[model samples]
Target: MEFLQPTSWTDALAAKAASPEAVPICGGTDLMVELNFDARRPAALLDLTKVADLAQWDIDDGSVRLGAGVSYARIITELSARLPGLAMAARTVGSPQIRNRGTVGGNLGTASPAGDAHPPLLAAAATVEAASVRGTRLIGIDEFFTGVKRNALAADELIAAVRIPLPVGPEQFSKIGTRNAMVIAVAAFAVALQPARKLVRTGIGSAAPTPRRAPAAEQFLAGALAEHDLWESRAELPGPLLDRFGDLVTAAAAPIDDVRGTAAYRLHALGVMARRTLAWAWRQYQSASPEGS
Candidate 1:
């Protein structure tokens, strides 16, 4: 296959716009696997790693803009202070070697429901920024994932960056995999306690056609927290409320039996994960440290 490396995003977009069929590659952690398995063979590739702009990041005004080429390693080390949930999810992505190359943007390019980064981004209420010859557009996380292995990105558009507002309180992520490292999740979940808004955001992965937020669970928790004034206190979430939160999260899932896990088991695991992550995040919220200390 012919490889075309562009030094800048403008050049890269022009190249992709000219050859919309050319596979756009950044880290190649995902694309290379498909190529090696003979699942795909594009005539050409648009390699964006050489573009300096796509590898840079900016943090300002309680928001972070991560470039498409920002690897899992960078997110874990540099962004952990600002995006603890994403950093925690990044830690579980793959091995050290895989993390060095694999990127959140690569996950966006593939749009796999099993991707570890998806749930955290969704829980953060992040935005995916995409650009093409036509121009740039920002898509909300809820609208980004349309179906299994699909996203809102168009054929000629490339992922430019992801924008996330800083978590106001504590956030957490959890997953159940057959094996911990380097294994796809049987079911994974992320929860972010937004104290400023008195909102709870939950993202369910692997057990859905697309990674999605558990809106019912979020609404339920929000009402309970507001009633109890838990957002400002050290009090624990009530047992009954926690149980119902897990049930609501489980109800939002539509899983299929696969080699990794059964649909029934996946639903059960989602409930457990949702409960655990919410408890952990609440504990973090109670901590004196605003940085989840």
Candidate 2:
């Protein structure tokens, strides 16, 4: 296979426009495995590691423009304060070596239902920045995933960056895996509480065809909080409310029986994760300063 390395963003865009079939590889954490297994053989591999622009991140307005090539390790060390939910998920992605090499962009490109990054991104309402010689367009995270191992990216497009709003409150993520490290999740969940907006958002992974938001659960919890002025009170969440939220989260999943787990187990695990993460996030919210210090 041919390997193309471009050092600049413009050069990379031009190369991609010229060879749309050239699979882009930044971290290569996933692509390398597919290549080694001979599961995928493309005519060309576009090496993006040299493109410095894809590894830099900056906050713009109220959101962060997270470069597509930024490593999970960097997210943990550099961006945790701004993106706690994503950082939490990044911590659970593979081993230390993998965390140093794997990227959120690679996870997006792979579009796996089990991808650890997807849940937090979905929960945070992130956006994907897709670019080409034509131009760049922002894709809503909710609409980015198309199917199992599929995404909405065009053939000639490359992910430039992801934009996620700065957290207005607490966030949490968790997953059930066979082992603590280097194992795919049987089920994963993330929750983000936006008290300023009086909203609660949830993301479920490894329990659906695509990483997805628990809209029913979100709406249910948000409405409950609003009804009780819980957003302002910062009172303890009732057990029944948490249980109902978990049930709604379970209802939102559409999983299938796979070698990793049964559909029933995934649903059960999702409910548990949803309750636990929401509780964890709410506790953090409760303990925070009045001004969110």
> Highest TM-score, which number?
2
Clashing pairs in 1: none
Give me the runs in candidate 2 sitting further than 4 Å from their true place.
none
Give the C-alpha lDDT of model 2: 0.95
Question: In candidate 2, where is summed lDDT lowest over 10 consecutive residues?
Answer: 284-293
lDDT per residue (tens digit) for residues 1-293 in model 1:
89999998999999999999999898999999999999999999999989999899998567799998999999999989899999999999889998999988999889998999989999999999999999999999999999999999899999999998888878899988988898889999999988877888988899989999999999999999988877767598889988999999999999999999999999999999988998898887787554433
lDDT of 2 by residue, 184-285 (tens): 989999999999888888889999899999999999999999999888899999999999999999999999999999999999999889889989988998
**TM per candidate:** 0.97, 0.99
Best by lDDT: 2
- The clash number for model 2 is 0
Local error of candidate 1 at 123, Å? 0.4
Worst 10 contiguous positions by lDDT, candidate 1: 284-293
